[model samples]
Target: MGYDIMKNNNTKRLAVSLLLIFPLLVFGQKRVEAKADRLFQKRAYALAADEYEDLLKHNWNTAYAHKQLAFCYFETREFDKALPHLQEVLGNDDLPLRYIWEYALLLKAEGKIEESEKWLAYSKMIKLKNPLIPRLSQDSTWHPVALLERQEYKVEPVSFNSKYSDFGARIYNDTLYFTSSRKTPENNSNYSWYDEPYLDLYYIPLSSLDQTPKALEGGIRSKYHESSPTFFKDYKGKNSVFFTRNNLKSGQYVVGKKRINNLKIYKGEQKKNGTWDMSRDLAINSPDYSNAHPF
Candidate 1:
């Protein structure tokens, strides 16, 4: 599953993916900037990067353009390309704290450990909530050791996978539950960010591997995404189910022009007949941020 969700207005910091190409019209620089901004808003990082690069070539360079270009490359996993653009603007006071953290990560990815640690330390001074800071600090004095032996392992693909994205598998009792973005005849809506079908939970009995996977019933599967299913015994010793779903309030997940549908954790109680009654959203869920992968 995609780890980071982008927030609206370019204010909140997050991680990346996906890109597209756009044409450079014979127009003004401001028009190009506007088009780039629109593409970024639509989560088309590739096209946005192209537009921003065009703007820079025409001597319309600015901190915003460089920052957006860096983000576009970062989202596309072109860390080598993103590093220079991030460096171009990191010295600017107007740059957000999140980009500083990203700069440190880019350095680490490029094997510049000492430089990465320095930037990570500076980022921690700003009090940003990055998991890498503590981890790098703890492992600062650690060194790699040579291994004298190798372990043999066998790898094979599961036969029950479709062409679309299928992952996040978890086993509970005799059932194997997982998340998939495969399209079905009954539902064909695609998420604009990846142009893939929204995720849904599906399960197959472990004892009956030949049988086709079935979508969960009882309103557990919705039009939007429903993924990362987890099973546990509740405090009262009742069977409990926890999963991640888009923030829903008035039967709609997207709101206004931003198209925000932050993920939240949901809980379901097992009924006498074995069907789950998932009618409550846990208090730990937040409408503004995502809380996923409940174990």
Candidate 2:
């Protein structure tokens, strides 16, 4: 009936609880901070979570309790408990923007994609009404890459997406190319780690973003994976593409002596009919290690 996060198979939490109580004995507890805050500061999150939950039960400083409890659950990776408590904490206007980032990530983990993206976008707004640091440097001179972390940027979801995963977007010659794990007819394999479809390169026209992305085929697509594509508009009068793929031996995914298969780099040139022919394998690729994301 309580927030004892340590699993039933563990005895370490009992020892931690004893150790946590000794400090409260030595310090002569006077308030909730003396119990939960001290445990939180000591990084005893599993124990602190219980005390904060008790505070919630008693209706004492509920917001503070929610804040500490949410963090306690978060630190312990108890996201199911953390989400509701964190939602309460977000009501405070003074919450650090970092928590907003955390909430978005949690939402994404819960598969609430659109809401997660919305908060992710909202995180860039000015949280501080009056910032003290002046951003200008060297008599109003500025470089695009200078102090980029200090700059504000907005986030938005691209129209082309999968409920699975899609990222590593790059724009070349008015087309957007990226890696996606969405199922396609040619891509029948699955990456076992996440149980999702194997990745493949996909592209969409920048002119009509609302349309579904077209999967790149020919030698550029593979039965295993094709990702992180870099394009050259004119390589000897034909467009070229460089990408990463699983090591293939005689049209089968190759496994090394150690039973490890690694990604290798391949380059190809576009044909006059817009199909691609597999060119040469990059010499830099090694059978022992992975080579990916060629520029």
Candidate 3:
């Protein structure tokens, strides 16, 4: 009888030992995860991801783990893994805001329109303290999304012979001013791109039409890359022109103002008098990202 009791006691002790060992195994996985996090902080995303995979084998808080793992995947351009993590976060709304936008954009890029829109709705709930979030509509990252909403925009096909690609249109006082890329006669055959006469501005006049709008040209011009144009209507009823000029030497674009009587179009150019004093770049524009489009 005593022998039987000793055998039973041994069996019970073995079971308890296995239970304690199992938890330690789980805790040991965290060491691998910690190493991965360190690698991620150092921007060694690929190595971090490898360690994360080992940690994932232990099934450690998969939802959050996958989300973080996905970020590393994204940083390394391993988009496939990043996607599932993003999907997980999308299904769970409590995700951090920074990750929400990242995931939404990734979904949008993948052509998952419905899903992306759903996430974007949630992203809108996270308001930044700075006033710039609303202003992001004008940013390039949002441009494609903004284009999606303009489904009802009237399309007009207008083309010109000059190489002028960046275009903005403004209508004022029965006239139109626009920038174009055309070389001047004085410019060399191997012309400096900026100094060429073709780099000047051009415009057209709008005359009476019963219904149709017609664009007619005025000959006056500027000599630089005068690209974006905006009309500022002051409170006192006086309107002024604001535009950007690309400096040839510095390779920097600047914004400036000019007084125009006819509202005629002018392409930017360095005048014979070197009066580039009329332009400067606005502070609102990011130096890294161009603010070329005018609305």
Candidate 4:
């Protein structure tokens, strides 16, 4: 009986070990296609291009792979590398309008004027509602034209600007709110795409520019990103705030294979106590799409 109990315990231990290591093993065993897709979704276009090329080397040539490879090269501005794949995908009947538009731009960049004009005309015809397409179609001659007049203005950096990325400044009444990725013990995790600390909402009094900025109170900041705060009068006529944050599920940010840290719009109300009472995510937010830069 004791021997049987000991064997059962050993089996449980082994099962636990496998459970712990399963994700890593799966990630390690991911195919080139899967890895390339994930990297593309994560906006790691350079790495994704390499994996896509690996797929091509293994004769995994498909329309989708070629299109994705072209997109990756296009995003990285490797126009020469992107040209052939773009041409390949353009031959397909079900090509998206954006791809055609990009291919047209690439042709123009490469000085293939006649070919570029053809693709540009096709793209314009496919997307008639897009105003830019009409302009491009009209102006088929692609050449750098110097601006006759330039407007220059003096700009100065804010006093509270830190060494880290500080941007997306907005003003509400006399308060100035902006996003920053300053290092803090609570926000130590680095954003993979930018290699920077997670952004947080910080504010200072516009009247008192010399004052140091402070992170907003009332649990407004999280371990993940919180940015682009916009204040407006809601239907209730109360001062309401809207900001962008990563979608959280079960008190944790959802992240895994084919899953990304998508941004959502969160609403907050200024309470009588001067602290914000943040509500759940707005109905407009979706885990699949990023909703940011609220006006």
Best by lDDT: 4
Top candidate (TM-score) = 1
Candidates 2 and 3 compared: the better one by TM-score is: 2
Query: How many backbone overlaps does candidate 3 show?
Result: 29
Stretches off by above 4 angstroms in model 1 are 1-28, 38-63, 73-81, 87-97, 110-167, 183-188, 193-195, 207-214, 233-240, 254-260, 269-277, 283-292
- Please provide, for model 2 over 1-295, each residue's C-alpha lDDT reduced to its tens digit, 9 standing for 90 to 100: 2445455535687888989987875454336657888777656687788878877776767888888877877766677888898899886888876566557667655656577666655654544332211222111123221222333568778767887779888898898989999986766566543446888888898999999998886776667777888888653667888888988866787866666788899987888787776787788987788999887
Candidate 2 has its poorest 10 consecutive residues by lDDT at 132-141
* Per-model TM-score on C-alpha atoms: 0.59, 0.50, 0.42, 0.55
TM-score order of candidates, top first: 1, 4, 2, 3
Return whichever of 1 and 4 wins on lDDT: 4
Deviation of model 3 at 279, angstroms: 35
Candidate 1 lands at a TM-score of 0.59
Error of 4 at 189 (Å): 2.4
Summing lDDT over every window of 10 consecutive residues in candidate 3, give the lowest-scoring window: 259-268
> What is the lDDT, from 0 to 100, of the residue 112 in candidate 2?
67
Q: What is the lDDT of candidate 3?
A: 0.54
Model 3: per-residue Cα lDDT over 190-261, one tens digit each: 212122243344455555323322222121223434555565554554444455544332443333342111
| Per-model tally of clashing residue pairs | 0, 0, 29, 0
lDDT of 4 by residue, 1-295 (tens): 9999999999999999999998865554457789888888888787788888877765675677799988988776567788889888987878877778777776665667688788777765665356677676556433221011122456778888887889999999889989999877767777654456889988899889999888886756677888999999899988889998888764588653447667888998887777776777888877777888788
Whichever of 1 and 4 has more TM-score, that candidate is 1
